[model samples]
Target chain A: MNVAVCVKQIPDSEPPALDPQHHTLVRDGKLVMDESDSFGVEMGLQLVEAAGGGEVVLVSMAPCGETRGLRTALATGAAKAILVSDPVLAGSDALGTAKVLAAVIRRLGPDLVLAGTESTDGYTGTTPVQVAELLGWPSVSFARHVEISHRALRVKRQTETGYEEVTCPLPAVVTVTAGVVEPRYPSFKGLAAAKSKPVEELTVVELGLDPSQVGFSGARQQVISVRAVKAREAGEIVVDAGEAHERVISFLEQLKIL
Target chain B: MDKTWVLAEQRDGTPAGIVLELVTAARGFGSVVEAVTWGPGGAGAAAVLGRYGVTKLYNLGDIGESLPGPKVAAAIAAQLAAESRPDAILIGATHDGRDIAARLSARLDLPVLANVVGMDASGGRLTSEHSIFGGSTVVRAEFTGAVPGLFIVQAKSFAAEAAEAAEQRSLEIVEVEVPDTGPSDAARVVTRHEEEHSGPKLDEATVVVSGGRGLGSPGNYALITELAQLLNGAPGASRAVVDAGWAPYAFQVGQTGKTVKPVVYIACGISGATLHVVGMRAAQYIIAVNKDREAPIFAIADLGVVGDVTKVIPRLIEAIRARR
Candidate 1:
């Protein structure tokens, strides 16, 4: 079955730098594939391989029309990609992102859609389900294991306690949990092939979306203030010196944990 | 704010721990607090919910084996369409909670403020505070459109306390009629496999011992569980360890994993990535043991120990055993 995987190209940083004036993340810089999306890409590739027919399609949104991250995923094995990059889409919230992605998926009409449980940077963890809802399709989130057969999907969904085997019909959305499958490293031939792969770019207007409904203009929330949290003061730090265990014992004793 | 709603999720015929926490937070909005619950536990949880300031409760009845996301969202949407809208809806940031919130937001064409850690209803408006960059920065945001703003609150963001209602009035439990959500409700659970865990629940434990990549290998994780067992605590793991297949995702503690607030948290070989730090920095006391003294974990750790986890964990385990 054809799979449309939602990939996010986020700023690569330990803690992403924030825009001082806007109180939002600075996304105009170099972008890379979010590590979390790698799992989804790998899962999609495997699903396509198992299906033995349809191809994997990458769907993503990035500011400044950057495709550097999409190329990384393309190198892994996706047939092609659809990138939605526009100045108007700069301050899009989860809902707006979902709107764009849902529109793209609707156009492709893939048998199944895949996404990460959450992005490492934004981490809203809401976009996949939002896309599913907007498309009027069933969604299964936090899937650790997924299998498709006879035009149906079975997923091992993660919960607080363990996992539940969930079944949904075709044309559904499933968000894969990180590390559920090992992502394959791009081979040298694959890397060379990615450069020649097709990437179709689209804009909000081209997608028939209202300007007032897809970006900073369409944002429903405002960041009022941003401030640094009071750093936690460090307590006693002791070297091992063959006596570190005593310190832990004494500390726990003081807390009555011992 | 005239009214607020809390989505009540239950486990084993009892409300989830975050249900009351959401109710407690709803009370702070100075509105008529109402709760919505699905399946078997609403009737049983009403009195306790009332004790925590929920004035009304809505039961959508049982949903059989169908997933709760679509049906629950449709039921709540029906209530909104049939009755007056509330000022806000509070949902826990759990697996099902996110699903319901996303569907509800899409159905209503409204935006949801997620990952909320704190909120204030000052000056006749509600603003939410989100802990970002691994608890290093707090961002306050507010919705600009539509009534009944949706907030997916993080667990342990508020203390759950029980208190009698201000007035001695009986709680009104309303039975909500669910609407057909069509194919959206097609996902069904066929089987369940709950992992067998022996100690206290990870998020509820008074003490938590988490291991990371610093443990070197999966076998070394035994030291973590051993230490936790000796201390009557729970075992946790950083995202790295979980991703490395050293532990289950249920044991993962990070921004995308479980948020824990134990009294004491011991980190073995953890480097304290920002994603992992946000989950446990709320613990009352933190101790980090790493061979690299410059690990970011040391910056926030209440007690930092410079030593190899494989070597130091065994020593600490022996000492604690001797004390007992």
Candidate 2:
């Protein structure tokens, strides 16, 4: 019942700053665990707690051999972590990421894997299923509720209109949505213990991946140009002055919505 | 001309609105447009699809209780393997659509350009435009490898338009076979639950009133509901309030939630983080009501009110009721 959770260490800013020249996200700062992954970590911890005889492991890919974010995730009770860090891995696309993560999961041989439905920064929302595809494992995305029953995973998967109760066997991947579970705050004791937690670092080569098939060289898509979205001109700003509602109602009247 | 394919979805024989939108987008490629669909609704949707310029409809037939991701992807991949490959595959970024696209990408070892808001096909190459950073920036990208690039397009990115009467032709129906890929396609939907809801669907509402953390307490959310009901609009919540458990995730309007493009969107006490703004910034008109005049939500708002939502909402509700 070993569980592997995919966590992303993202730049610690909302609307992350992009490199002026490269037009890419600036990742050379203090990175933190993406808030989105916190839910996956919490879900993995609870799943292990319910299983009663397993450990939750963290898997990540970050630059500069960083483990700061992984330590935070470990502080929440994951046993250890495996980080794939290499300069060659920079500029990797979603499929490249899925390849690295799938390789790591295959090596660990976890019975079940968990990930956020999408990273707050990237929001591609395709990596977990791609990882499942590469691993030849079943995947259930947008799981609002997940429970293990006799080596089978029962999940409440969200849909466009409602939700569906779905199930799959072990050795599967499940991507949890944000707000699906309340993430626990890291205790002082747990934070102190995280320093001693074992973290194994690997490179693309170590994972038996060719450098040519990763990063910019392996990227299948190229950004042609980047530009700011056309700005909408500010219409009107009115203070409450005890009659702001009147203004809103009048404005809606103009639009005929009222 | 390039061959463009759209993956369509339908429920109970009714095509999802985005499917028609994808069909319209596929036609924009100025290529031979085709469609692939699954479930019992596939056959039922062909006539409407034909009118929308889909010359051929590849039906995967009924997939039973099996989750449609792997099965549909396998079926599409099988078609690609057996026949001439399409130059482009357009799929709506819906729940099952993402799954099928990802699986198909992995199966074919291809790349997917997701969150596409715009597309341009010039010189026989397809370039996709993605709206990012809360729709504040647009990035144009294209695939450097592989044919039939998979694209998961955002809903409502394009208008759904049917063909003219003179151009609507008889559609060709092709049955696709789903290859059994062992346990990888083992997930099954055992039951479905539809949460009780009333009023117009959130994304389809002419007017949308969304509440944020500024509403203070979960009980205060009643103001949002009351106001929305009075306006005949749908009530929405920011991710902050949804994450705080004050509202159902269904009410969430944000990057990870439902993208809403209403005629008018009223934000009550929402600070307007980029995550939440991305979902509603496309509204025809935005009005922000926040005590903090400097809130980001007000930056994009057509009308800005510097006031407390708890105080402003009740007053606004009364005014609307009086008008009625």
Candidate 3:
């Protein structure tokens, strides 16, 4: 049960930064494995572990050819990683990012592909499904639980009404939602071993992906503009009095329907 | 014909609330508003949708009472591949809607602007305004294509209103062509359960009370829910609590979860993480109770109480009951 997990190295920011030239996320600064992708990595590692023998591989695209984010996942039991770093991959939209991931994944030829439902930064929530399409595989998105069998995978797909048990054959894509499983923290021994693990770095050319088909030129959607969210103007701050609950009641009463 | 189409979601033979809302929102795009629906119960929804200015309806016929994701996606692609393409296709930001949009975007090779709050076409092109970064900022995106723009608008992004009797028009039901063999044939729901949640849904509730990691454990989450029940509000959880398995994902309200804007929101045991703030900042009135005085939630809280939720929530519930 070889698994490939798609991870994104996103900037760690209170409010994310944008590259002025590209009007996209500024990725040159400190990068961490996107919190969302951690679940996918954790899920992949567990699936491989449950299968008794196989490897968990991570795939990520970042600027500066940074391995910081990849190291974090590698520490959490991923056998190795594939980093696709190039100036040409910058400003790639969801679809372009999916293309890069799908290409790298094809090389690994993993039996299953896993990804986060959406990244916290861009939050387009489309890349996983796009990767499935690019690979011509069935996708089960918003999965809270997935049981992988020898020949098939059953997913507890989340929905507004609750969950649906959806099954698909092997070689499928599944996107795990947040808190699907508690991600394991990298242990001291795991961290030390990760330092020596092999991380295969590749370029678009190596993956047979056209550079022009990615980055700013390949992007279907344009930012057009980026602006800060209007600061939520603070209204009132009250220290808790002994009768603070009364204050809340009075506040509701002021609305006249309380 | 010149038109825009809306995917009308339905339940139990009646249109889902989002369908009527999308119909009202679709009115902004064009006058010849059409609708498409799958399965057998769509006929009952046609008149309701017509009241909201849907002039034509595309029925994909019966596929039973299940979410036929691939079948619906292929059907819509077949429609788009017809002699004429619509100006735009609007779908709600629901789970099934996202699934459909993802598949159609792949099958049709079209771009889908998702989580859209609003859209307009003034400069000879349609641009969607997305409320990103937790609705703090807005990004306006224009579809490059000449026609058949795809957008998955968030629920309640627009107000739903009834068209005047004179404005109401008859809708034409056109049969749609669905692929005879597809993913739906093999997929079946083995078991399904709607969570037995009390009060309204966190997204739909007029009042929402939420908890966070500060709640300590799954047992403590009950305090948040109890207060919510007292207020007749929905109980929501921050991503931390939801991710910690303290509460169900459906209870999560954050950037990654559902976006909720209730009349009044009560945050208990929450540190006011930025992601959590984005989802609930739209509330008309916010009351945050955290032991940490400097929790970021205070910045946005209309009234901030620096205290322990364990101590405050019980008292607050008592206060409400006493007042009643």
Candidate 4:
């Protein structure tokens, strides 16, 4: 019942400054773990704990400075952390990122892989499905709840209408929505224990991944440009000092509310 | 030059709303629009596509016997890749369409754009516009490789035109048996649950009435619904209301919820978070009603009524009914 959680280091949505010049996010040299990925990590931890024997591995692709996010995952409950970081990995979009993740999952040979439905920054919601395609595995996205039994994994997916329950065989990929579960914070003891855990660092070359196989160069899709949205104009407020009923009637008449 | 291809998603043998919208959006490009569908064997899904001005319709007969993401995507991609190399592809940004678009983009080695609100071809390149940062900003982009462009059109962004019903024409139905690249490990579809709501959907409605956290509790949702009914439109909610469990998540209009481009959007008891406003900024007209005159929603609202929703909504509903 081995499980792998693919995490990404994304720019915080509330960035100090947006790089308008480059039309890219400027982190001011600070990288934060995507909040959605935390749900995937928590799902992995829950599965490992329920299985009572398998391990939960945290996998990520980030720069050297991004190791702190991996460390934080380890502190939370992951058995170990694997970092696939290199200069070549920069500017990889969802598809390329999924390819790298699929390669790592193949190397680890896990029974199940879990990922967040979408990262907050990119918000593509495509990586997990793409990764599942690359790995030739079944993928269930927007899974709100999951139960892994001996032969199959039962899941509840949130749809526009209502919740859908589905059961798939083992060795599959599941992408969880934020509503899936509440992530746990790293405890004091867990933080100390995480220091002793092994952290394997792998470069693209070490993973035997050809430089041409991952990143922007390998990605099929490219973002040609990004522009800031136009600022909205302020509205005129009509404040009438009248009785509550009179004011309500007058406002409705003006707005054609009636 | 090879023409563009549009995947016209159909449910139960009829083209979905977004499919028509996709075709309408792609019509201005002036490329040969080939509509494709994967449905039950011998189903007349292809015949229906012709009404949408699809020059050619490819019905890859029921590849998976049921609508599964990978199976449908593989079948369509394999056919499109082998038969006609399209210069670009368009799909609706629905859950099912988005899944297939991602897989198709990966398989075809093309840049996949999602949530494109508008697209125009200029200087031999297609520039697609998308709303980012919860709709606060609009970004235009283009693909940069030999591969064809792939885009997922945002829902309700384009108005769907009813294609003229013409004489029945037979379309080529190519059946491509996708190789079992992987085991069938997906959870089987056991049952489906559909919510019953009257009136038009909020995203497509001409007028939308929405509630926010200012509506004290779930019980107050009736006021929002009454207003929507009076307007003969649809009801919507801000993320705060949905988060508060006063309304269903499907009714939420925000960064995580549905993006709507309606004619008139009225926000009642909403403070207007950027996330919420982004979803509705594309609306032709916006009106905000809140007790706090300085609520952020007022910044983007075309009209503002500074009043308490609890007092205003009931009176408005009564007055509208009285007029009738």
Kindly list the per-residue Cα lDDT of model 1 for residues B8-98, writing each as its tens digit: 9985458899998988887877788899999876678787887888878899988888888999999999999989999999999999999
- Give the count of colliding residue pairs in each prediction: 0, 0, 2, 3
Q: In model 2, which runs have C-alpha deviations exceeding 4 angstroms?
A: A13-15, A19-22
lDDT of 3 at B18: 76
Which of candidates 3 and 4 reaches a greater lDDT? 3
Tell me the lDDT of model 4 at B118. Answer: 87
Question: Which portions of model 3 show Cα errors greater than 4 Å?
Answer: B64-67, B180-187
Cα displacement (Å) at residue A132, model 3: 1.4
DockQ of each two-chain model: 0.83, 0.73, 0.56, 0.50
Over B229-282, each residue of candidate 4 has an lDDT whose tens digit, in order, gives: 878788999876775667776788866677788777889999987668767888
Sorted on DockQ, highest at the top, how do the candidates line up? 1, 2, 3, 4
Model 1 chain A: worst 10 consecutive residues (lDDT sum): A13-22
- Residue-level lDDT tens digits of model 2 in B89-203: 9999888999999999888988888999899887777899998887879989899987889999988888899998887889999988888888898898999888647999998
Q: TM-score: which is higher, 1 or 4?
A: 1
lDDT of 4: 0.74
Best by TM-score: 1
Error (Å) of candidate 3 at residue A143 is: 1.3
* Model 4 steric clash pairs: A221-B111, A229-B137, A229-B138
lDDT of 2 at A132: 96
Ranking by TM-score: 1, 2, 3, 4
